[model samples]
Target: MDRPHWSVPLALVWVSSFFLHFAWEMWQVVFYEGMATASHAAAIWICTKATFGDANIALAAYLAAALSVCSIDWVRTPTGTPLFFYLAAGLLITVLFEYLATEVLGRWEYNEQMPTLPLLGTGLLPLAQWIVVPLVSLYATRLMYFGFLPMREYAANKPA
Candidate 1:
């Protein structure tokens, strides 16, 4: 089988990740102190910047998965070890960044509404965001790459 051009999956990963993370960030803003009080434009700008960062993280995770599986096309049939790498990389990056931003750098603070882990104190929503958004992004990438049809049907009907 011909290998897909690298750009295809990368582009899909970025686009899907950006939009999904943008929505997640905007929705979870209320959990962050001062975000609810911020001007609409300011909130949007902050979320947009964060979304770009999230998208970059997603791309990095995707690349890690690809490297683990030795296939750029792994997103098409994500499972087992590659999927583990993707999730692990995203979670690790998110945990470290969240700790730094919240504790060390003072980049942001969780409001009273935010539920946090005990030791790390990372916000639950952000951790959930990293887990949920990347999986959904990968699924969306697969659907977009393989068309709207179900994967099994698409595979069976595809021409050899």
Candidate 2:
């Protein structure tokens, strides 16, 4: 099979990551202090920005996976090592950033509802987000890339 252009997988990753992360963020907002009472517009804005960050992290993880296998097409048929690199990179990044943001920078804090890891105290939701979102995004990418999810036919010659 012919390799898809690099942009194809990248676009798929961004779209999938943004949508999944945005939904997760919205759902998990109540676990964060002050988020549940924020104005709708403010909540949307905050989630959108965070979604973009998540998308960027997904892109970076995708790149890391690609580099592990020495091909951007690894997403087409992901396997052991590349998949490992993808998940590990995303988890590592999320843990470090979550620590820095919550502890060092005081960027945000978890409410009592938010469960945390034992030692690092990283929120369980964010760690699960990294794992779940990337895996789903990669699965979505594979499905789309293989045409399992068909696009609408727009041929000019077909029945009008």
Candidate 3:
């Protein structure tokens, strides 16, 4: 069968981005210069801030990957589309969709968990999940979607 193709591979890729983001943040805390200079407690505080909460770098990475993968373009018409632009659009769509979904779940003004609902990333992360997610998605979409990604003639048809 068709390589058991479902959404598993793509989903895994997105999940991987989360751990990767977390690991990178951890590394920065341990190795980056002038990091947490005040004390060990200070260092932990910095690490915690970078890794969790609204602006949490780690969580932001996951969100970015999720938006990116979901955003990939599939041009229906014949007029070819730019991969980067398609990626951008996808990202933008993901962000907008997410914001709308969140709002529907619970209006921001009343949300204690997310105090600053109107200003995403001021309390969130990506100034525009609109732009950042898609830039990242460009790679993911190209990797996953055969439509946008060019086929290699060298790779023959799969075995029966």
How many clashes does each candidate structure show, in the order listed? 0, 0, 3
Give TM-scores for every candidate, taking all chains together and pairing residue i with residue i.
0.92, 0.90, 0.30
lDDT of 3 by residue, 59-154 (tens): 233334444445322311112234344444444544554466445543222123322336542223333433444344434543554433243331
Candidate 2 residue-wise lDDT at 7: 89
Q: Worst 10-residue stretch by lDDT in candidate 1?
A: 146-155
Model 2: residues with Cα > 4 Å off, grouped in runs: 149-160
User: Where does model 3 exceed 4 Å of error?
Assistant: 1-3, 23-125, 128-130, 141-160
User: Residue 157 lDDT in model 3?
Assistant: 37
Against the true structure, candidate 2 has what lDDT?
0.88
Write the residue-wise lDDT of candidate 1 on 1-160 in tens digits.
4666888999999999999999999999999999999999999999999999999999999999999989887987777899999999999999999999999999999999999999999999998998899989988999887766668785787666
Q: Quote model 2's TM-score.
A: 0.90
lDDT of each: 0.92, 0.88, 0.39
Best-first order by TM-score? 1, 2, 3
Off by over 4 Å in 1: 154-160
